[model samples]
Target: MGAAFRARTPSLAQLFDEDMLGDDLEAWLNESFLLKRTFRTCAVIAGLIDQRHPGKEKTGRQVTVSADLIYDVLRMHEPDHILLEATRHDAATGLLDIGRLGSMLKRIKGHITHRRLDRISPLAVPVMLEIGRESVHGEAHDFLLTEAADELIIEAMGIGHTAGE
Candidate 1:
């Protein structure tokens, strides 16, 4: 018989050790919503394992969805790097859901059209025209977009607006 070899699996805490800021990482993972918590936790743990054991190849379980499909979804939902960065920072502080707001705004902006609305209601034409005009002015458009995003976030979260006030 050939020489016997033992295969050992490391515990999660061992894979993501304390020396590598495991406590802070765990806290961050725990703070995420239920929908994202498992995937984020696995990603963090896999990343840590890869960092610690660069020589060993780490393979994940087969996923039903293809990588291309996942990339397409990300491309659709996460269009702006600035918005993504803001969302990541806000996650730690529990400030706001900027990602969702940005996604909603993107979809709404895409659907805004004079021809489409003209068929539905002629009275709404002036409002669409005003929106089109505001969108052309850089600074005004940015301010309006931010306000709309904030309002969308607040309404979705069912939170009070103007918390300090």
Candidate 2:
């Protein structure tokens, strides 16, 4: 959201400009948290997870590994696995009704109002912010932290922003 970047420093947003929703909805909502949530949901559905078990106190380790570890292992070794695909595909492409979703994307491609914003738009703030805040997900933790530290050194030597800062 441009409001998040209005002054180059994050200020709590106060105004609301309800934007039109379209096929690009997928782009905004697809993030690791949503995927992880979907995996946990699907894991429960697939009977791979038992999120609610009576008298079963959840441990910290269990909290950390609920569905993510299984999902990650499956993703690495069995990328074609249904649950793995569901983790990504469900959240990324299932935001709206399945029947009409495909047509909306095609319409977006050649729509009369198609254009790119010069600055980050308000609707894009969540997904963009999510990119940095996902250090705990997959290999992103190592890669993002290393990249940020490298940028810190580069910034010390006069360089560019870190992770789209």
Candidate 3:
């Protein structure tokens, strides 16, 4: 007789980390396949991100965000509930709204926190664009880019880096 066999399973973190996975719902399902330890890791990361960013607002190309609170909230919940809250639109220009972007960030952070990982700090503006890129493009991208450009102008003025090259 053939020997009995069990299929190897994947973890929630791995699934979410996969480039193709669309959102949190997909990641949660991925968790079912993971070993206990992996699941814990996933949850920790989600929690940390959540604790770090709390209130999120759309502010041109990048959303005005608070990292600490977001990390804490994520540690307490599952992804299913969070993804359900995100509205799907054209991948291009879909997540441009700061309100929506903030919510999504919260969800992502929440996912990390639940897994019990430390929150990432020194939150860079580029990080926000990268995270939301999958859902934004075209005019939306332009809008964000323009906003970033304007901010650079204001920031540059404050620092005074003259062009003399």
The parts of candidate 3 lying over 4 Å away from their true place are: 1-136, 160-165
Candidate 3 root-mean-square deviation in Å: 21.1
Measured by TM-score, the strongest candidate is 2
- Evaluated against the true structure, the overall lDDT of model 3 is 0.40
Where model 1 places Cα greater than 4 Å from the true spot, the runs are: 1-31, 34-72, 75-80, 95-165
Ranking by lDDT: 2, 1, 3
38-68 per-residue lDDT for model 2 (tens digits): 7788899887877877897877666445577
Q: How much is the lDDT of residue 1 in candidate 3?
A: 6
Candidate with top lDDT is 2
lDDT of 3 at 82: 37
Which is superior by TM-score, 1 or 2? 2
Question: Which runs of model 2 end up more than 4 angstroms from their true locations?
Answer: 1-31, 53-56, 59-64, 96-165
Worst 10 residues of 3 by lDDT: 1-10
TM-scores of all predicted structures = 0.17, 0.39, 0.16
Candidate 1 worst ten-residue window by lDDT: 1-10
Give model 3's clash tally.
34
